[model samples]
Target: MKIVISDYKSSLNFDINYAISYLRDTLGTNTEIIVYEYNGNNKEFIDILNDADALITGYLEIDKEIIQSLNHLKIISIMATGFNFIDIQQASRSHIGVAVNQEYCTQEVSEHVMSLLLALNRKLKHYTNDVDAKGIFDYGTTNNLIRLDGSTLGIFGLGKIGRSVAKKAQSFGIKVIAYDPFISEEVANECNVELLPIDDVLSESDNISINMLLTNENVGFFNMEKFKKMSKRPYIINVSRGALINEDDLVDALDKELIKGAGLDVLVSESPNLDNHPLVNRDNVIITPHSAFYSETSILECQRIACDNVINYVNGNYDKMFRLINPEILK
Candidate 1:
């Protein structure tokens, strides 16, 4: 059997040696494994996967043409929670199964969300820049700091990460409210959060954290109108997909003071043109290059689950593959 691992970016700040070793041990000597750090050539990408039996993709998009070209491919495992880069329907039609690593980085992401909240609320970035570059020790210039205690935290999605964020925020005295259309009231009660309508969450939150999946229904969901509904001038934190918020609208909101500030880990384009990017060099906005789901431990665990899913499927142990996105294709 042949296995391929593609799409390795250096800036993610973690080595894939552990994942490689794990795959080596699990698949054994008989299986052939090749790892490719993708260089942006569409023809080269398709060529690499032409004879692939199983694939592990990083941040590459797997569209219909590529899916159709992957003749022998039985499985495509994504190293991240969101599998939006893959054309699920196309893969299914081609009888290719898809899997994602959903549970591996929940703690890492939740912790990162809290880290952004704390840093933004406390103005750590602002003061650090002020003291380092200008050599000015004046801390009184920016005084938008507010006590997190007794403040409301509105979560946009009540998924595993969102629930974890809520639990973690409670320790900092934040009252958690969530809005997830799919989640039941019982689940919200269990999470100790009041489930509200999306509009209400927008209007009432002292600070907002986005934790939803990126889907067609919610692309550019947070626009000028949504920002205007925020009565508290809330700080917006998005550790989720970048397409969830309209970048231009977000910048306009910051300009008009409709929102207090933003902590964004993802952007609409992964490789954004920084020269004209609106959020960069701003004191109020914090951007982390879509790295919330990263850590030494989390990356290893995520890659393991992603690889194991394919290995299980190949070994006729489909029951063990926990995060299969296109399970029907397995049959």
Candidate 2:
């Protein structure tokens, strides 16, 4: 069997050698594995994927064109939770199996969200930069810092990571409310969070954290109108997909003092022109390079689980493990 691992622009330094060895041991000696460091945009990738039995990708957009070009492709597994980069509908039509590393990075991402929340609430970024760069010794200049206790935290998506964040926030004496249409009120109550409508969550929260997956329905959802509805001027933190927030409107809200600030782990573009981007060089804003999913352990676990999903699927154990994007392909 032929397996191709597309390690596109990966900074995790994933243990590809270990994955290769594991698959070889599980599949057989005849297994051929190709590891490519470049992205899927090149003709070279197209040439290689022509005969691939399975493909594992990192941050590579696999569109309909790429799907149509594959000759013997069985499965395309993404190394991240978000599979929006892949055209799932196109893949489904092509009868190509798609899987995502869904269970990984839950803790890492939740922790990062909490870190950003605390940093914004305590004004850590402002004071740390002040002491190190401006020789300022006074915290009074940053007196806008608020206490997390007795404050409200609104969660946009009450999925696995959202529940973890809610529990952590509760430990800090925060009142947690969440909005997820897919999740029931009973489910939210079990997680110790009040289920509220998006509008109510927006107006009532002291801090709003986005924990939802990015879908076509939610792209640029937090635009000027949504920002205008935020009655408390809440601090917005996004550990989820960046396109969920409209960057232009976010900048406008900050400029108008309609919102307090923002902490973003992901951006619409991973590599933005820093000079012109309004989110950068701002005291109230904190930006992380789409790295809310990184940790020494999470990286390895992600790599392993992604590879294992393909390993199990091709081994004819499709019904047991793995998050399948198109289950009908298995039938």
Candidate 3:
């Protein structure tokens, strides 16, 4: 069996050479892994997947033409939780199963969510900047940097990462509440998180954390109207897909003080020309370059599970753990 890997840059941070070795070892000698840069090059992609039995994609979108060309393809494995880049209906029609690596970095992202919250709550980043320039100006002096001991934490999505956030945040003695339509009430109750609607969560939360996947139905979910509903104007943190929140609205909110502040590790696009971006000059807004799941152990785990999915497909084992969106195509 032949396995091809492309759209690696869509992932941006994944090491292709590491992926290649993992592919070679997992599938053994009968299977080969091909790495191609996915840049809308149909000819190149067609050439690479000409004899491919399975294809592993990173970030690049595999459209209908590409799906049609996967004549011998059994699986389209993506190395991330989101499948918005993949055309699910087309893949379903093609009978090419789509899989994603979802389980590997739940803790990593949740931990980073906590990290961002704590850094903001304790004013760590602000004081670090002050100390960098001179010394600590005054203790707890960055515009009412608050404590999490008796706060209300509102989690947007109550998936694996959301559950992780809840359990961990509860340790800080914060009341955890969640708003996930698909998640069960039992699950939220077990996590000690009160399940509420988005509006109420926005209105009452002291710290708001978003971990929702970005879908067509959910893109730009947090815009001017939603921001206007924020009664408490809590500190916001986004460790998931950037497309879930409106960058311009967030900037305007910071500019106009719509919310308290935001600690963002994700944004709509990788580089939306930050020089001209409105969030660039804000003292309250904090940004990380989409690195919520970037710990050493978590990365190794991601590659391991990603490679496992590819190999399981090669071995005709259709029960990979991390397949998120296109679950029905397996049949």
Candidate 4:
């Protein structure tokens, strides 16, 4: 078996010896897999991908052209849960099996969301930066930071990680309400979360946390209209996919003081494009480099499960773990 791993970099900046070792072991005993440093719009990647038996990718986009060119391709393994980049319909037509790393980093993502929620609520990011600059920053001077206990936490989606976040919030004496239509009322109630409409969640929340994967229906879903509907000064946090919220509109809302503040773990990043982006200068707006799941525990789980999913399928048993996209291919 031969596989091509794209969007992988071996820069002095990133340490990825563990991932390389995992791939080598998974495709052990003369099975060949080529790993290439990512340089977008390269002919080398196109050439390598054409002859691949399977492919693993990080952040690069794979369109219908790439899918159609992969005559030997059997699988498209995404390191992340969202298959937004893959042309799923095209992969299906090409008989390419799609498996994503779904269960890994579940706790890390939840923890990061919790961190952002607490950080924003307590004005930790603002004052921490201030203290670092001035040598002393007061608690009362930054803003009126509030306590989390007895406050309302509105969860956008109540999947695995969402439930974990809700449970953590509940432990802090925060009331949880969610807006996941797929989850049964009984199941949500068991988790001690009130199932409510999107609007109601926006209206009543002290903090609005987004934990949903982006679907075609929800692309640019949180727009100006939704921002306008928010009442009672809710802090917004998104540790999920980036496209779920419009960056431009969010800056506009913040500029107009429509929302209280935003704590982002992931955003659409094209460095120079977003360098002078409106949210950069604001102390209230916090952004991370799509790194909600960068802890040691999370990284190890991602390496283990991603390699296992590909290895298991290659050995003839599909993982029932958490297949997100192209389930029929496994059949």
Candidate 5:
């Protein structure tokens, strides 16, 4: 069997030496393994992937046309939870199994969300600029600083990372409310989170954390209309997908002071043009370069689990696949 690992070196800065050794040890030394680093030339790497039985990737975009062309591919294992980068439906039609490492960076992401929330709430950027940039340090420079102990934190999606955020927020004495159509009231209550509609969560929360998964229907859903509903002028915290919010609407909301501030870990475009990017270097916006899911431990865990998915599928141990996105392909 032959396997190709792509996009790991540049996209994720991950070393797949462990994966190569593990696959060779388990599948036998004769198993052919290829390392293909994507260099923005599809034709070059497409030739490499054409001969592979399995493909492991971090951020390579495999669209419909490419999926249809790779006739030898049996599985594509992703190193992250979000699979929006890949054409899963097309892969399914092509009888290609897709797997993801769902829980690898849960702790890192939740903690990053809290860090952003706390920094925004306390005007960390404003005060830091005041002192560092202008050489002035005064407590009265900024006002309306609220205590997190008595404030309400509204979560948009109550998935694994969202639940972890709720748990962490509670320890800070923050009230947790959530808007997740998929989660039941009983489940919310069990987590000590008050379940509410999206609008209600917006209006009532002193801070709002977006944890929703990106999908075709919800792209840019959190626009000016949603911002206007935030009666409390809540600080927006998003460690989730960037395309969920319209960047233009978010900038307008900030300009109008409709929302207090925003802490974004992701943006609509990962490689946004910084020369004219509206969100970059704003006093009210703290943008991290989508690094919320990074940690030494999590990276290794992600690599191992992703490789395990590929290995198990190649070994015909289908049940051991980490988390299959297109399980029907197996049938």
Candidate 6:
């Protein structure tokens, strides 16, 4: 069987040889591995993928049209936890299995969430900018600062990363509450987190953290109306998908002081033009280039898990697959 590793040589920042060697060792000498470095030319890569039996990719959008063209493709393994870029419904219709490495970056992402939350709460960017630009070193610049020990942190999703964040927040004496319908009350009790309705959480939180998975129903959900419901004018921190919040609405919220501040790790467009971007060059807003899931250890583990998923699928070891998005294809 032929397996294609696309856009990995330079884009993913990991050695392709490690993945190639892992696949070869498991599939024996009969396996054919192709390392294709995608150069933003989808048409060319689609033509090459037509003959691939399996594929491993990072953040490539495999739409219905592209999924239909891959005649021999049986499985796709994503190196990241978010599989919204892939057309899972179309792949399932085509009898193709889709899987993701969900366990690789839980700690890194949760830690990053804490970093952003603390930075926004303490006005680190605002203070540093004031000192650097104007040589002003006054501690009385902002009087709204409050200690996190007694503040409430409302989490939008109580998944693995969310639970980890809750644990870390509790260490700082912060009260934790969450709004995830899928998570059981028993699980929330075990984490020492209060399970509350979405509206209640929105109205009562001193700060908000978004850790939900992106879906069609929740895209652009955190707009002006939602921001208005924030009675406390809480600080917002998002380490999740950017499309979950409307950028225009976010800017309006900041301008109107509906929110204290925002720390975003992802944006609607990965390669946004910064010259005229509203979120850029703002003291109340902090944006990172979507690097919350990066660490040397996590990078290696992500590649290993991606390769293992493909190897397990080839060997009919479906039980060992990590977070298979489409399991009906196996039946």
The numbered model that scores best in lDDT is: 6
In candidate 6, the residue pairs with backbone N, CA or C atoms under 3 Å apart (3 or more residues apart, or in different chains) clash, namely none
Query: What local distance difference test score does each model get?
Result: 0.88, 0.87, 0.79, 0.79, 0.89, 0.90
Root-mean-square deviation (CA) per prediction? 1.4, 1.6, 2.5, 2.2, 1.6, 1.8
- List runs of model 6 lying over 4 Å from the truth: 8-11, 29-31
TM-score per candidate, chains pooled: 0.96, 0.95, 0.90, 0.93, 0.95, 0.95
Stretch of 10 with least lDDT, candidate 3: 7-16
**Model 6's TM-score against the true structure:** 0.95
- What ranges in model 2 sit over 4 Å off? 10-12
Q: Quote the positional error of residue 322 for candidate 3 in Å.
A: 3.9
Worst 10 contiguous positions by lDDT, candidate 4: 8-17
Which of the numbered candidates is closest to the native, going by highest TM-score?
Answer: 1
- Clash number for candidate 1: 0
Candidate 6 on 1-331: residue-level lDDT in tens? 8998886344556667888888888888788988888777878989888888899998777899899888799899998888888999999999999999979999999999999999988899989988999799997897699899989999999999999999999999999999999999999999999999989999999999999999988999799999999999999999989999999999999999999999999888755678879999988789997888888888889889999999888788999998899999887
Model 1 lowest lDDT segment of ten: 8-17
Q: Residue-wise lDDT of candidate 1 within 226-300, one digit each (tens)?
A: 998999999999998999999999999999999989999999976677896889998888999778988878877
| Alpha-carbon RMSD, candidate 5 | 1.6
Candidate 5: count the clashes. Answer: 0
TM-score-based ranking, best first? Answer: 1, 2, 5, 6, 4, 3
Error of 6 at 124 (Å): 1.0
- Whole-model alpha-carbon lDDT for candidate 2: 0.87
Q: In candidate 4, how many clashes are counted?
A: 0
